[model samples]
Target chain A: MGHLSAPNDIEDLLRTLSPQVLGALVRRFDDFDICEDAVQEALLAAATQWPREGVPANPRGWLTVVASRRRTEMWRSESARRRREEAAFASAPADIELGAVLDDSLELLLLCCHPSLTPVSQVALTLRAVGGLTTAEIARALLVPEATVAQRISRAKQRIKASGARFRLPPEAERSECLAAVLHVLYLVFNEGSTASSGATLHRVDLIAEAIRLMRQLHDRLPEDGEVSGLLALMLLTDARRPARVSDDGALVPLAEQDRGLWDAQTIAEGAALITHTLATAPVGPYQLQAALAAVHDEAPRAEDTDWQQILGLYELVRTIAPGPMVTLNRIVAVAMVRGPDAGLRELATAERDPALTGNHRVDAVRAHLLEMSGDLPAARDHYRLAAQRTLSIPEQRYLAARATRLAPDDHA
Target chain B: MKYLILIYSNPQSREIWNSFSRDQRAAGLRDYAALHESMVASGELIVSEALADPSLAKRVTSHEGQALVTDGPYAEVKEYLAGFFLLECPSMERAIEQAARIPEAAFGLVEVRAIMALDGWDI
Candidate 1:
């Protein structure tokens, strides 16, 4: 497990309550900007005031009152500036009581992903609004500038307001597209967590945990959606093997070399059941295909017994829908195992010619392994050197360099 | 959100593109057209246009209070603006996805920028 900075109880309490408090405000006022700001202020207030005073008997009530008042004040000041004196939200919410507000995290996530925003904005807004991440936290997670994330979120909110997007879920006819957007963001978070784009650590487990938690919550709300279950299954199956994915020294372990006994059986079973159920419904979506692929790997008790042929077929399907270098690389590896090294080399040569994989470390790593397998130690050494040069992770660099060094004693390949 | 998709063509990409077979060029155009049609169907495309050849270009400048115009296809950069698309998308991902689907993006580059505020012109 990656190092998880265990959030203190206070931050945990606030994070848990954020969606509910913000949901209530949005439901009552329907002003995303004002309500969001009000709720943020209220959460900040709770962060300070909650510790000073004993926990309130009615925490939601306290938050509702504070956020509502803040929103009302904002509405009043804006109307005054315009000199319109709008009747709506003119008075403070002194008498308004905290009603039962549905957990609107899923709804809020969908709202943040409204089609008018770009993918970057959707991810930023979702992390801020539903994930309750500060802009700085989001910036760190995305490996981008704080200012850029701030601008994207601000612009997304403006676009949402201009489009008059609804806070509630869309109609059934439009639900599929909206759901895809929601799943895409979650998947992105999962990918980032599984393999961080840069820096020392190979994983960002916090994001993985966050995404899984959110997906679990979503599954609880909409259990019937096969794709939802499929996505959750995919994430779980992938996360299940993470413990065995790294060595004691933190170097990445290839799937074939990983200790199979260390894989989490409970998670694998849960994910397998979900994938089986989802696939029974004849769903052939990206998540389902990926989950099926994971299942094929997890079902094998030993690396030698892995269902490479099944995985190869699944990869072909995945490539048809989502053609990319990484997927092709995996497929190439599978082909190498099933057909032979030469067959894999033929496919990999085509992939090497692809512009998408130019200078990509994974591609070079695969090339080195295939060349080594084909009894071409000199070429393998050269490719390993290239692989070491291409990667950012310290562990990956060491691993590739070790391979290069093990192959040849002299500097010349 | 509204995005400006800028299509850029560099001399290297231009050379590679010009070396394509006629059928390959036609296939590239077909892909671009298909991508545009899909965006139109999804209501994500607000406007898109391919710029005329830069060889017929004119440059205009303003000094103090006078309008100055110069005629020539002259630029100092290896990359030149080839075309653009103004799209009202739901997210940056969609805009980028659309931009990447542009045929020239295979050899050149496509950059997507979100407009800050719509104070001028009409949506």
Candidate 2:
């Protein structure tokens, strides 16, 4: 534990150990709500003590013991008869073996993302129980009130308890579906972190890092699962481009215009290698295909070298497997690149008929890009302005408006 | 302390808003979004919302114990409350700073009113 020298290192270590400690407590006590609260107290105690007294010889064992003791004390504060039975049962000397406790993390994740809980609760609980973030940290990350986060987490634990979910993996029949839900939760967290929808905060970075760290832990446990590898690869590749995603003025820089030199090369290499390996070994999934797309964009030395033909083919696969409005819109952009803008516009006209695509700003943004490519400057400017007004994101609005202004005549201004 | 920042707009300003170009409208929305983002990040924002048009408002009155309802604009005031931000700030200056950041404050009045707690008033 001497490796935990810096304060930042200590924080990271605790975040990593938090789920394991909570998992062990719940497994022993069979009470998710009480166990979670006890583990949080233990964590707070450790957060304050470790730096002063030095890291304990066995951090996980130490936390498990402390949390178990707290659980007993909490039960003791109840009715005397209930306390006698609960306290005695809780204090029964169960070995807090480190190796066995490590396995509880995955089960904790599963229970946090149980089907009974809503998506919001799942996210809140997952960050609290698995990601080791405090309620305040989760509240700030999600931009909700601390009370709201607290309520969601408590509600989620109660739901899981009522569902009678065990402290182990779901049955074989439900394993894949449960895993998919877990993946979706992680995906949602990653996307929320990467985008920074409001466009002015550092809290998003913490979420991004936490999502990736949790994904890495999952990947480590299930090394043989390709989709897990694919999801992790996708996050790393997308996050790698973050450095070049925005300009100094806080405006979003489109992929084509971003400086390739500013991209994080090490992350790109790691992501590309992971995807390249997974794509070869595993059945194709949506996440793997998306990661493959990101790899394609990252591998090209310049925007001109972007293999659009291959991208179009991959989009075809994605649409065939899991079609959505955004997937269709992105496919149209690739269509414009490979074919001509007019060809893309024809497809866009039909795609816009879907009610899902109506009034979506990205559609207008795509239309503007195609119009510009087709030499219709006035029309492009109009669509850009319309798209700018339709978006709520400040950076996207500014970028679209700037594009519109750039195309306007000097006298028109 | 908690402060209520009221955003007011008059007919003249509404006309000006109607006359604005698409880019101007987008710019206004962007400024509002940025201000909201900053407030959220700074933990000053409790809640904020834009109200529907005043024309949609309904006025309710109790006349001789019977409830009566009618369309709004009971008085021909120069301005109306278009939106508001309920924020928790450390000081009046901080509240004022946030109020000034509201895009409407550039031309129209953005008032900052203190929210009185039960303990603040004497019997």
Candidate 3:
């Protein structure tokens, strides 16, 4: 990966490799920001020295050594009394196993996404340290002001420091619980890529790819975990339809209007195999069940051929396990498709009354669609406007506006 | 290499400070001590200290060729500048490393800036 060394280029390289390098350094230093800073200094040194030295044989290992040495030197120069004290405590020679440290970076990813932190903070830091995203990139993906993302990252780092969180993988006993957090983070990442809550384009393929890569890493490490397999299936099945989700103008193409031939057959096949394998082993988890439902949809050659009953059943299971407002909203759509629009409208009416579902644009959008299907053009138009007003994503807003436009003529006085 | 790490806090208002119990304060102090020890061991930290509450402090600023004095901080904010650390590091990277180690940064802010070099200024 040798190239012309410029300041911007150095920054780009640091952003790309910071997660792996900083994670390894944290294990060595047991301090997140210190490790990060040392790595930054090492990179700066590299930027100044590497061009002259023509890059090291193993750049990562070389950077780690340089950063670790810098830390020791800085410590020694700071205080004589503390240096003597540390010298007394540091009786044993330090081990510098770069390979093992690099391998432990995966564990750091899990820790970064731990449930202790808020989801926003978890996503921000995970993107920075695990996905190797710049703070600006994370800010853009999150649709937050760049300064906000920077503050969140700083606060998250400070909290991790104050809590004395270690740099090792969760113990065997806590692996299941810890793995759930990791999965949740990856799922959020993939979802952001799949639909993209807010962006000029409806999808961020890079984020989706990065998430798939991380999920594959998880599956490799924990082969017996059915949920891991389930998650992989869910992502693949959902991603299989990416090609058919948009038109050439980048406008969203509803599933019913999409050409089935455009779907990625390879992804769909892999997803179906994973889902089937997962189902055979144990009672399928929510992700696995969702993947199964998507598989049913994918199996159908046309929209009319979809097994709505099976999808509704899976939704029922998903709602029972992970009963969220979004799941309920999805369940309503399935009900409307299987039974009638009236039945879906009834389900949505109940969800709309729930305080937790209030202000949720997806619920409003689903309600509008059901109302439109049921021939209540006026009510559907109202809900469509509501959905458009509530949604922050440009793509979603455009979809709602388009739906409203399509229903406008019938609603006109 | 010379850096200024300012810690922001409000001393007059007990509301924010009182939110934490005695044990929490002790824990904070312990962490601060540990960080101080680490900074001292690292040999980059020059001098660090906490202020005696902003209520008891005064600000002197020059305005329009005249000296202006204020009874309280320059601005009325929820948090005030509570302490600082003057450090000499080899680079901005080291300065940030030390900044992150500050105890106040866990709950408050710690801004790190490099000191401007003067032609004939003596340390």
Candidate 4:
């Protein structure tokens, strides 16, 4: 807390400590719902007071004390109003060791991403509990109503309570599975920010930053876990190109067309170094392979200089380990880049049989690109139009429609 | 999931209702009351209400800055929405089961439709 020079730095410090303080409280109080609310109140207090009064000697300990007091006060008033003696006893534990709170960030993350909750609920609760975002902030980041975010978070916590899950890690048999759920939630949060599915704005940077921050914390706690490191690296590598991902006029610039000069060289280097270290040291997971793929993209000085051979090999490994429709589509792009457009089109025909790919705009967009490369201008234009019509993202629609328009006159000629 | 369970009224159903004995009509009302009570007890029902006469409905259209009014319950349509139950169910199957419990389902006039969220799909 000594280097808390700027207000932004203080905000970051608060966010980083929010989960640790909440984890400590919930572990001791054994009441996640009340503990979460108390922690939010504590965070709000810190946000307002930290900059004015100067940073505390131990920010995390200070937050835990404040939140614990709030929790006791809340329960005490409730118990008195209801005349429930047990509530008072439960609220004020005699052995409260304020200074000896252990970091329970991993356990908190597992609880937030509980499998009983729906993906939407998991995303909302994870943002609030682990990422340290408020309901209004989460709603703004997700382009959802505040009520919806609040409902999801509350319902998720209730479900966790109903599941009878404790504030600790799962059993050895279930630990890896639970950790996978946590990683998936973080991946979803990052994806939501990387691509605004149905919004006017292309990127919700707040969510992206939150995802990376949470992933970094996870990595710090479980440094030996390859997938955690891989995910952190992947997020960094993907986010590094964000500066050049959009045009001045707010249109999305596809990867091949983006000006590489605008990419964050420092972030790329960091991500590259991390992934390179991970792939060498740990057993390769899907995320690590994806990070490797992203690293290849980031290392290329120009779009034309991209090593499609290496990328294609990596996509193959990613597909083998974790097959997904998007991975299939990306692999086809690499196929076209390496072999030929006709070869890619042949692969696309087989991939079109996948139920998940049916009616997906990205498939159409990919097909259009391949057809354009194969000198099938009319077909490419039609596919572009289809893609433009199918996509919900405004920027993607604009870009696809522009591609179709660019080829319209050529059709007549 | 939230669903709108719509009960449709047609000329045939209305004729059958009109022809029912007093005892039968009262029994029908009892069935609806029972269903409403069960839904409320289960925390499934958000709101439910019967409609006014469809003939009283009016259609409004703007034409060159002028508002034009026309009689609704279009003559060509055979079925009109009579009442609806707004229910929060766990799944489509549950909503359908609730819709089947409605008295109008005997006439094949009850329908269950999922309510769309703001994003069209969940995150």
Candidate 5:
């Protein structure tokens, strides 16, 4: 094994090998905390040894071999007799195949994001296990206290172990439901990057890139899973416009005002191709249908060229499969664009009564826009204020506030 | 190989639970009984039982120099431990498979833990 020379190269190698080593240790120990600690120790050893020895030819394999030995040493140091017995058992075979173990890491990823755990825990654990991100990095990404993120990760690992959650993709019968949970976490990560639930910037490119990487991994593993392709398409299409999502001054830019030329044509093309391929496979699911709609919007050269009628039809299909208030609210906007603002406002009024949309900021923000367009300036102003108060993201709040300002009477101030 | 499965359920929703018809209760009981039989057949189940009502439960915790006793349930939460099962399996994967088979997991919660085989412990 040759030692790593360049510091930058070593850092990259460590980041890449972290997940593999963690996956192997987790498999052997069947305890995330112990596995994580062992992997960290192995990393520290690498940091000291690699600079002197140069980088290993297969860094992942080297890390696994070292970490496995360290775990055995720790177990033995804790108990002699048990260690002796376990050593004898361990000597029967050294079955630590790095490639197979890394493949199984996807199973671990899904297990971390299992619906059984809370959403916060799901995201935290996924970042830890899959992204190989430190707890502090996760804390920064989530905009929470580092200690809180640390505690959540610890509790989540403990619960997973105590629940005896298997680190494997669920059976085919349950794959759809299980994959939905994984996709939900990835989608939430993308949404956070795009709008930033609460952050100084409107978008975080790193988060979006990580999500795209994971989606690509899923697409590679499950080529036949249309929803996986659909999700990748959706992410690509949304991310294609990221270069135009904000102004040079870092203020939010709505899609209508965004520079169309700034959008990544390559991403848009790939997304459109994926959506078309998924649609060609008859009996497309909700996600694929939604991605198809996004593909259409991405193909449109301008806001006026948007096929709202087709978009509305896609939303109806999505509602049939996965009914939710967010989808309904989005459909209402499409209806407003095509039919009339009054019709859209009426739909929004009914949607506001939905338990799911009761406190949703986007619902109120859309209502404010429809009201403004319909000439009800006072009601629009009130709704905009309500939206601004409910929203957590500074950029989103600023946008709502600007809308409110436009509606406010000059004499009122 | 030894696993402990803890079942959690809402103990305070008498109105919702009591509304179940006799057939519903019987169906629920049958589901649980079938799970127990399956585990026993696989030679995984060691011991299992439903607990008494939460009102009869007692909790003992050591505080400072003295042991404190608690009345009724400990956490004052609607969801409380409803039952438990001890199983011996070939691997953690098998243990999780058995945990997922538990009827309580469908609508409630079932947590599984591997028994620590430290010195002085026996399974």
Candidate 6:
């Protein structure tokens, strides 16, 4: 593998080093905008030189030094016009100590997850600043307009600066709230990939992989946080089933119909171990509960053995812990599977009346399935068509459209 | 760097301020006083003031080498410039820091633009 200088290997190395280098520079220099730019410059420098000269022995340190130097130059130019509060940066130490450059990804995460920015801004900035992805790359993968993404990232940075959010972890009293913000951002990334909101494709492996990579980093930085492990485990186990989530022709495959043989055993084992450890301590966080739910499904040898009763119990626990219409929707499905379609319909009747879920496509989709299960194919087809029209995702529309068609009767003259 | 800090207030914003209770309005005004005091102490505050509502404003425009006067603020714009502060700050970030401190900024918008120094002019 020494001679294997694959392009992907270098990209992966740079991705890991970029955030650490950027985080280190931000901590040292206290300039979010300048640190981000300098880090990008350093990464560009590495990409040009590393292949020809062989990878550096200490790439992270090398990038840190280069970015620090670049940051100093930026200060020099800005200060030339006018003296700034950070004027001391001109004489930044030449040898940036390796030890002083702590891996403050937590700090970076907190900064990127600053509450002042909108959620879309937070996601865009998190992907660029900490995920080490370029705006074009992010736009391309997520299918957002490049201009929109660029504007969002810059605006988010300005908001963070203007709001005066410190580029460090919040004090102990507020740590959990800030941590929750960070976890929410990571989960958004994961969800966007695992189930894309709108796009030609059903799934984006690039984004899913990036989310998992960042979660692994978060887990490493925060080993004691059971929720972190829980999130990572949940992502891994869910991703292990990705291969069977879609058919060869790109049709959606429901979990019950997926081929168990297609699930990645190694990933499932790793996630199962993490969840087992997490549960030994009784992790009551939503992520842990979801992981436990996924684990039960993964452990089942066949679809009929899914342990729906246990899943129903877990769904109830999730509702109690984090009550929301979405959880209620999931529980409604589980009830249908465990008890009967009529039971599920009864549970959803309230949701149908609730203003929040009255027009929700997912609720409609679930209702369509329950109706189909209860032998009301015509009503199921109508609801499926309603769901197809309501969803923004092209793939989801196709899936629901197919469902509606499957329920249609044979046309006879 | 000298920055032109433009403070924009929507006429509708008055509704918000009016909706506040007497104590809430007092607290907001107190916060503004503190913000103004700090900026003045830092010597970054050059000139600042609040403006009357847009209904009391006028506009002048020239077309085809002729001057034309119009009533009210620019009709094409939803948010007219309500007031401004000319600030001599060290950097853009510092200007933004000051802009964010403005009490109205939270309720409306604050724009920080660098004041161009043409030739030897300095303020």
Task: Report the interface RMSD that candidate 3 achieves against the true structure, in angstroms.
Answer: 22.8
- Deviating ranges (above 4 Å) for candidate 4: A1-10, A46-58, A76-95, A98-102, A196-205, A410-413, B1-123
Over the stretch A176-202, how does candidate 1's per-residue lDDT look in tens digits? 899999999888777667765234433
Kindly indicate the candidate among 3 and 4 with the higher TM-score: 4
Clashing pairs in 5: A2-A55, A3-A53, A3-A54, A3-A55, A4-A54, A4-A55, A162-B112
Candidate 3 displacement at residue B88 in angstroms: 36
**Per-residue C-alpha lDDT of model 4 across residues A148-251, encoded as one tens digit per residue:** 57777877887888998889888999998999999999998987787653344433447788889889888988998999999999999999998987677766
Off by over 4 Å in 1: A1-7, A81-86, A90-100, A143-148, A196-205, A351-362, A391-396, A409-413, B1-123
The full ranking of all candidates by lDDT, starting with the best, is: 4, 2, 6, 1, 5, 3
In candidate 2, position A132 carries an lDDT of: 92
Q: Model 6: what is its DockQ?
A: 0.02
lDDT of 3 by residue, B12-102 (tens): 3345557879998898789889887665544445578887756676778998999888787644556777788876555667788878877
Instruction: Return the TM-score for each candidate structure.
Output: 0.70, 0.77, 0.67, 0.77, 0.70, 0.73
Q: Rate the local accuracy (lDDT) of all candidates.
A: 0.78, 0.83, 0.73, 0.84, 0.75, 0.79
The 10-residue segment with the lowest total lDDT in model 5 chain B: B114-123
Separate DockQ for every predicted complex: 0.02, 0.03, 0.02, 0.09, 0.01, 0.02
* Candidate 2 global lDDT: 0.83
lDDT of 3 at A251: 65
* TM-score (2 decimals) of chain A in model 6: 0.92
Instruction: Grade the docking of candidate 4.
Output: incorrect
lDDT of 4 by residue, B2-118 (tens): 789999999899999999999999999999999998776454666789988877788999999999999985656778989999876567788999898987899999998876432
- Model 5 RMSD vs true structure: 14.2
Clashing pairs in 4: none
Candidate 1 lDDT score at position A325: 79
Candidate 3 per-residue C-alpha lDDT over A280-378 given as tens digits, one digit per residue, 9 for 90 to 100: 996668888878888998889999999889989989999998888778888888999889999998878788888878777777789899998999998
Which residue runs of candidate 6 sit more than 4 Å off their true CA positions?
Answer: A1-5, A81-90, A100-102, A196-205, A411-413, B1-123
Q: Chain A vs. true chain A, TM-score per candidate?
A: 0.87, 0.94, 0.83, 0.90, 0.88, 0.92
Q: Model 2 over residues B1-123: C-alpha lDDT tens digits?
A: 578999988877888899999999999888889988777655567789998877788899999999899889734666889899988665678899889888778775699987632111000
Could you give the C-alpha RMSD of every candidate to the true structure, in order shown?
A: 13.0, 13.9, 13.8, 5.9, 14.2, 13.8
Model 2 clash pairs are: none
TM-score of chain B of each: 0.82, 0.86, 0.73, 0.87, 0.76, 0.78
